[model samples]
Target: MAIGYLGPEGTFTHAAARELRPGADLVALTTQAQAIALVEDGSIEGAVVPVDNTVNGVVLPTWDALLGTTASRIVADTLVPVTFNAYALTGDVVPEVVVSHPHALAQCARYVSSLGVPSRAASSTAEACASLAPGEVAIAAPVCAELYPVATIATKVEDGAGAITQFGVVSRDDVRPTTDRWTTVFAALPERNAPGSLAALLTPLASLGCNLENIVARPLRGSVDYVFLLFVTDLDQDREASALDSLRAQCSGLSVLGRLAAAKHSRPDGASGIPARLAPVRS
Candidate 1:
């Protein structure tokens, strides 16, 4: 299988892509939009794209890209832990010249503040680590040591290893099993601005026993409407209408952004990427 992930490699999305497919062929793209486009155009069978980070909240740009697409998705998420670190080139341990992905920098804001280092943003952690010299410097993961000619000055710099990210496996069509499947999508409701309009439309969903796994509002820059990324769990072909009806009666400007077909991604026998007790989470 061909897999696409946001990368220059050594990014969490890159890690997720490899973990999800094991030995599958992987392609790395720069931005979330690029990853989604690869799937939309059939260049790859699926993509590993960040949906949200525990500390950074929702990645709006990614959500927007998914919302804008007609692409289908996999419900199973690759939950990876985020632990930002400082990487330096060999003997280059100047705290003032730190380099890293902007998101990484933001996630470890406290550590950065304590160090009071001036950081330069890079596209990926590997790239950032590559730009540095070892000695008195470090990066988030020791897994990056193979790519960059640097040494880690510290590990797990971010307070509490609780920070995590959940990524969506984007595909061209629904690829989940009918049993235990959950569907997710982005939609825009008409009359989103009208008072009680959204509630009136969604009230029936509660009555119909639709359990929402997620419901997030996204800001639309050029329009007054808000986009909704809704994840409905326990979906069957027989029950598609109740969800659709909820959209129609309570919402006017409704549009399906994308759909996700999910099932529990099983752990491979003898696989040991992360411990079950400390399975990474979206903090």
Candidate 2:
């Protein structure tokens, strides 16, 4: 089977892809949109891409792409722990500039700030490592130091050791739910905005006894309107069908983004036993 991912290699997405389907043929696309496009075009069977980061929050591009695409659906979800390291070419002089992907830079903001140098965004952390000059530094995965000719100057630079990112495996086929604790759907609310509109849409889930996991809203393109993406659980075939019926009645458009097994990681203190990273959005 062939899979696509955002890359130049040495990216966290690449790591996630490998973990998702080890030994599968992997295609590296320059952008997340390109990876999804390949899946849409049937150039590849699926694509693994980051959707959210523990510290950096939602990845806007992936969310926007999910909202816009119709040919692909999320097949599985995975959480990869992240640790960033600052690397530089061998030199006695301190680096004058730092570079990395925006998310990586954000995760290591404190360390980057301590460097007291200007920072620039790269297409990917690997790309940044590949292009670094003698007096420049790249914040990237520890593996980058070996993949590219750089030395690790700092380690575990992320804000916390708990740093993790949520990745989705996207394919053209609908995946059957493997566990009761599975499934997430994306729905677009009606164009007309009014009081309690959001609540009305969510009422069905509550009525059906479905646990609303994560809920995020993104502004519709070139408009003041907004659309919500929801992750839900505690649903069976009958309940899922009923919930969809209610949502279809209330929404302008509805799409089952994906349905698969949920992640196994969970916080010991969490009441729902859901992974802290996947915990439901509370009011």
lDDT of each: 0.66, 0.81
TM-score, candidate number 2: 0.88
Give the local distance difference test score of model 2: 0.81
Local accuracy of candidate 2 as per-residue lDDT tens digits, 33-73: 88888888888899998887866777878767766688688
Cα lDDT tens digits for candidate 1, 1-283 = 6888877667778787787778988887888788777778887888888776756666766777776666555445667777665566654466765667677777777777777667777776766765554323434455786666666666677755566777777777655444555564537464557777657656776777777766787777898767566666666655555677667666665655444443334233334446588887777
Error of 2 at 84 (Å): 1.1
Shift of residue 74 alpha carbon in model 1, Å: 4.1
Q: How close to the true structure is residue 40 of candidate 1, measured as C-alpha lDDT?
A: 81
The C-alpha RMSD of each candidate to the native structure, in angstroms, is: 6.9, 4.7
Off by over 4 Å in 2: 91-93, 264-283
